[model samples]
Target chain A: MSRFARPHWVEKMSSGMAKPLIGEISAALDTLAATGVAGAIDLSGLPLTATDRAELEVALGSGEVEAKVTAAGTSEIRETGFAGVWWVRHFDAGGRVLAEILEIAFVPQLLGAQGDDIDAAARRLRTELARTPERETGRETVHAD
Target chain B: MQIDETTPNAARSAASGDDRTLGALLAARGVSRRAFLKYSSYLASLLALPASMAPAMAASLAKAQRQSVIWLSFQECTGCTESLTRSLSPTLDDLIFDFISLDYHHTLQAASGHAAEEARMQAMEAHKGKYIVAVDGSVPVKDGGIYSTIAGMSNLDILEETTKDAFAVVAIGSCAAFGGLPLADPNPTGAVPVTELVTDKPVINIPGCPPIPEAMAAVLAHVLTFGILPELDSLGRPKSFYGESVHDRCYRRPFYDRGEFAESFDDEGAKKGWCLYKLGCKGPATSNACATVKWNGGTSFPIEAGHPCLGCSEPGFWDMGGFYRALSVPTGDVARIAAVAAGAGVVAGAAAGALHRATKSAARGKHHTVTVEELEEK
Candidate 1:
């Protein structure tokens, strides 16, 4: 018996007819100019084809900053060639793309969560300390150098 | 920031007629230049100015001299004053209030009787063609403005006499902007907004049941910084604050776009955090910064607290139809309107379903198959 499995549905690389990306970029720029605040375009929520993604990449190109942040999974942040604009992607632990976003701001809001993460770590540490055998005495007898 | 132990020397400044700049007063208050600049940046953002304008705003505001303001009260509930007083704790708004030379305020000033009247006269004379006149309530034109008065003077007489030499006037609340509750149906006292009376001087209307405190503070900042009133819309409101409707900036707009609406107060849709458009939210038509700037120091606003907007900032909102009635559904001939609305909704639904199906089929046709080898190559 043949063991070859049939290939299922796969997304195609579209013909480069994706011009709506230009409007999205323009709107983001307009918003930033009018309001001192920032806005985001969630590509994951849109029906963007592979060709559309490639076209957007060609238009914006790449920029300097590249950072990998960890939450439930890895979130990649890359600055676009356009000043004050960024390309961000979130991927699950299985390496499946979850979200793709184009952010326009003085600074991306994704980086502002370090303080909250620190607070979470503090709570976790306190919980772990409470379960220790020496915690009942409420005093530190052994010290680790 | 530290208190300089010297109470504001408004009396002395007025007596000597010395043009002391705001920088000098902030210096006296021990407010550092950096802190002042930070406050300026905050004000710039609050006023919706570009971030690059912060330094210029700071420089201009710093050099600007104290503005003599005369506050008149009439046919009002004192709620505007109460709202202005509820700024953030140790608020910058209070500091800005302190920076101004408030010459006469019936509710706030310690002086009563002839003393208050004398203060007003002196300040008006000293700062002729320079002072700002801020009125908080409606002026009753009917019956010779006899329904309200100050020191035996009718509200109308006092308003005309006081603003004769004033550079500009700021109508502070809905009462002063559009004749609030006092001018409701069967208005016997014949209360009218200040804009109706003060035609000579420029009037800026900060219309709200009780206008936002920051809004009032920002307007004062604009006057103190630029030496002019901020840009006004057709209704004489500051365009920066009333530029967009509450619905345009609402957080639940995505739900609206998805056509998920809450039909009632405690429905499953409401609990699911759906749009409140069907539940009488006037946000779509109401223009105000309550959805953005919020109240009580950037805290939750009415809509955020699950209450429909009452369109308080717009003129004549009080005379608008029932508060609980949706903007789409009018009060007159409800049965007819409902039937028409239902018909329109059905047609729209069928059109939307067809469009959605077309989009799905197009995506399917565009789809291509990839082998394991192709995935490995990528």
Candidate 2:
């Protein structure tokens, strides 16, 4: 019975269906270009096999922009070879991928600094400056303009 | 694994008469805008919403006030509460605590007895029609609900009163969602799910023996961020999590398609990691996120660990045949046979037979044999 058993299931990871996914991404990119509307495809929600993912990665290649955002976890956003396409992966503290997305946009939304944060930064800076001796002594206002 | 024990600065300020938005609270804790953006994007993906909605979700969450939550336990094992506290995702646990003011929970609260009760009443009165009511156990309505009571108040009465002005009623576990184990066959106490009693409010069912922690957090986050309930399925479960059957997402799906099955626990096929359908896996009939979101921080689900799905998320699962019996096999008086079979299976067959009869009688529907091609279409 042992001899008659088939190969291990791990060997069947490749579904050989990456071409259609690439086509779908191309179509999304086209839509973004035409309508100026960014779109995203949730890779985690798809049924892509390991080989399919590998094929997609190779097809997309890599672009110049790459940044990491740390919040609830660490998110890595990198531009694909295509100018308007980006690959985003959000990982938990334990380094587990929580979500994988392919975004079609000029820049991923997570890269931009929000208005609330900028306001908070300004207040925080003012508080720090108030605690400085130079500011208290009236030496910081040297620019008369 | 590092739990931040210090109370967030925003929470402290809120206590000191500073009414601040969640954005101010987060910023006080030195959480940057990028973090919010990342979390919002992650939430959007998790909720199956379009990626374009991430910015809006973030904006809404930032401007929103902290939500008041009241947790009421009935005839339960406290496993649901345990599951929630042990949420594997690091940030989600913090985010949930930061987003809500848990005014009442018997197990976790410092104040007990009268004080705890008063806190719940106060929160209800203050928040009124805005607070969320999360219930975790089946309500024993038999004997005038004398089977279970807190402070001499019956579970039924408490549920009705608490949910009267609630924004939404969240059924936290299988017991609260589908009348879990307590409602099985010879249900002596006449237990029923939360939906039966709370008819006015939107009841979101997150059913499992002890539901996946992330699913619970995600539902709460969706509600808190959007100021409304997430889209629910026919059974009142969030479609984002319960949209697909376990088998549809299982890695062993290829084996099932090839007709390769594990015959027994220690068989060659089992060792070779074949499909467990023959050994009574309930994956096909079960709709849950266990296959994808998994448990224990994306490590592995029951199927990955070589156990067949118990179909814990579905209604009347406790009565649905035996765990080791195939779904294709029709059951007859399973409750009685389960007794003779003893420990081999729980309340076997009869419940499944009853369900089939119920479905047929209600819909006058025919049970058609599905072909491989038809299954592929789905």
Candidate 3:
């Protein structure tokens, strides 16, 4: 493997320097793992075929966890015990790659000065989630965490 | 004390001829009155003043040829001068002929050699204590000011002599205002800001590579009309213009609040036009009214052009890291730290800001409610 391909070495690289491909990918891990807000990152290594890249985008962007139906037939969102998992990927300046996918679970917080509006809260969260740039930028059903 | 109405004096006539009106001045001479008024108001408003203040802004402008302004040029590309002259809306020509008296600008005026020196001395004598002194570029203080000189006089001596009895001093461009480009990294000339040299009078600093032309105009107007100087900021800049940062008024601020960022330069986020905060925008640290005041008569600003703000208006901006990297704040917790930037220095409790962005969004959702108990079962 080239000096740029090792994950451990990449992680150790200086944050300001021109990052090796793997090092660039590792930076995404740092940006995402620390923040719940998912970001698209780029990795120079592991050039996924166009078909594979599309499939991954669909899988990640698909809000399958949010779409899960509770055991009682209610929405997973209404279920207090529910949590959602998502992967944050890195992208280049032009949306190409250089990093590992950092997966984290999002525990939605109760909204408002008085948590009085549940449905309103749900719709609000839905919009925020919509604006979230998914790998593929679309919706699909998936499993909840 | 009654405000004395004697500023322009002989300085105005000498620098720009005895034409009070811009239309007549431009007509008989060259720059128009309407264009002059337009230029006057355009720059005044950039300071966040009312549009109606333009006429009053103009009347107070000292225009006597007696008002000698010795523009000291130093280690600079003269981009500020070029930028000043290229102002097309009202045009820089109006400023030169109609604004405060321009006595001896090396860039303009056909006088050369001993004649130029004589012209400068003549204007200084004619205006005396009433003239305005403006300095461009940085003054090198090292090696007894040996790095730069004019007529064998060091930039330091020239500055000291001229600023001794000036009505008010204006430090135009970043060079004079702050150390500017010359002060950037390993400065050899021992370049120092104007603040270091002048101790007797209040110095107005108009910082930027060349500074906004309107900023230069408004300062002249403020001094001419008010004569007591406009309100200054911590950096000694006028508060009217440097009061707010571009980030506070950016149109893409909402996107940042929502945590939506442009993924790349040409991706869907870029196509949709998302926030450039993630892309090394120095807007947050910068303090300038560029977003609200805009440029070229409300034409467009840096952010409006679909680029991240380089924060050129802020001091030592060039030394900052790359313009495409996001500033890293302490990630106390994803939710909590996000609130810090969101609350943005508000002490109403960190979570309050998060709650506000949440409540506001929740109120907009408008959906049917479901109980936690029901969700637990069906």
Candidate 4:
């Protein structure tokens, strides 16, 4: 299932629009960024391949956005929009993963028997993300003149 | 694959006197370096050590021997044992045999009754002054200690007998550490922690409802290798694992700091995995490795599993209050205005009162004012 589909239930209760869900996703990514989870994944799965990273270069160019093969599972952020990756085994693709990503994570230190580095990375990434200047998206001012 | 060698220098000298690398050291002792290093690296991370210490730890581990452990079950459920035995990674047996020798665990051992008592006695005698004694459940000291007994002896007597010559006494589970459910208010059993009963020996209390299995294993390791207990907090819990509050390490801590809280169980906060403190999460006060170490094989914990903390590790946790009652935290700068307003009101009232007095005094002090009015006055 698509990652957005989980939180999209809230959107179903909306006026049949997905903007609320998208907003939730944005907030979730922000929180994750504050926690050192910096990248974003598109759950619609456009037949992504090893080379598709280059094909989605336009999306990747957004600076806040990055794409890679996340471990198959919903990253639940709860209904505003977006999903949190369930385990770090998926984040094997993060920070430049290697071949047999599954093997390296399953080696016991990553997530299975013992948890590793998720806390430090989350703190570091989130602090760094919070400091970035807002990428203006036209709603900068709705002030009452 | 389990190298139970405890002579670092011997293992080194034995391996052609080459002192570098777990590869060479374990190879000298006929243990696979990969397997040893693999476990060592995992243990190092569990202790929150940097990646650089992996080699040194592995090398030192070549001489790490399995200390004989006699598991003593006291007045309680077998949850702690169950938590350890069910570990999914290397498995708890791997921990028991590979690291420390579990000489006699009543639940896991095949022997029972007279044979079980004999085994425990032998373990204490054979490994005398060197064995590790792990106690689960609390010791009921009331009514002549008749509340719980093993082999016709009260738990208090058994603990005293078993721990008399032990290297270190470890209190596992909340029952043994902080007196689990049996310790709740109006404790008829008069349950007391092992630390209360064992005054002669050093006791390490791993006090959770059931402490994370890795935490249990880590304590055992530090005890075996260093021959010194890990630095413990004021409550006798090892600082490496119980140093910080679960809330401090929780993933939802940010939401909490921002003044957001889960208002209800099934609300958006639960879905967002936001802070559950407002909903009476004891993470702020209770200490354990739950947030980062997690559970269900390091996957999640009570908060992540969408439950508030019951404060199982803290003393008098069961009686202090309900799990859902918001702990009375200082209302922060948010309520500072009340005091400020109070001060302002006192000053304002005094000023008003003083102004009236001053007006009366001026009239009384008047020398040439209102002479005609004085004449017209009756």
Top candidate, metric TM-score: 2
- Indicate whether candidate 3 or candidate 4 has the larger DockQ: 4
Q: What TM-score goes with each of the models?
A: 0.64, 0.85, 0.57, 0.60
Report the C-alpha displacement of residue B378, candidate 1, in angstroms.
50
Q: Tell me each candidate's i-RMS in Å.
A: 17.7, 6.8, 25.1, 13.3
Model 4 misplaced stretches (Cα beyond 4 Å): A1-145, B1-31, B91-96, B329-378
Candidate 3 structure quality by residue, lDDT tens digits, B147-178? 98888889899888877777778888888888
Which residue pairs does candidate 2 place in steric collision?
Answer: B321-B349, B334-B350
Candidate 4 residue-wise lDDT, B191-240, digit = tens: 99899999989999998877888788888877755678888887798887
The residue pairs that clash in candidate 1, if any, are none
DockQ, model 3, C-alpha based: 0.01
**What is the Cα-based TM-score of model 2?**
0.85
lDDT of each: 0.68, 0.76, 0.54, 0.57
Give residue B59's error in model 3 in angstroms.
5.4
For residues B82-148, could you state the per-residue lDDT of candidate 2 as single tens digits?
Answer: 8888756776445777777787888987767776676677778767798899999999999999999
After superposition, the stretches of candidate 3 with alpha carbons farther than 4 Å from their true spots are A1-145, B1-44, B50-68, B90-96, B296-298, B328-378
Best by lDDT: 2
Clash count in backbone of candidate 3: 40
- Could you tell me how far off, in angstroms, the CA of residue B205 lies in candidate 3 after the best superposition? 0.8
lDDT string, candidate 1, A83-117, tens digits: 77888665544454434567788766555443433
lDDT tens digits, residues B122-189, model 1? 77887889888999999887877788888999999999999999999999999999898888777889
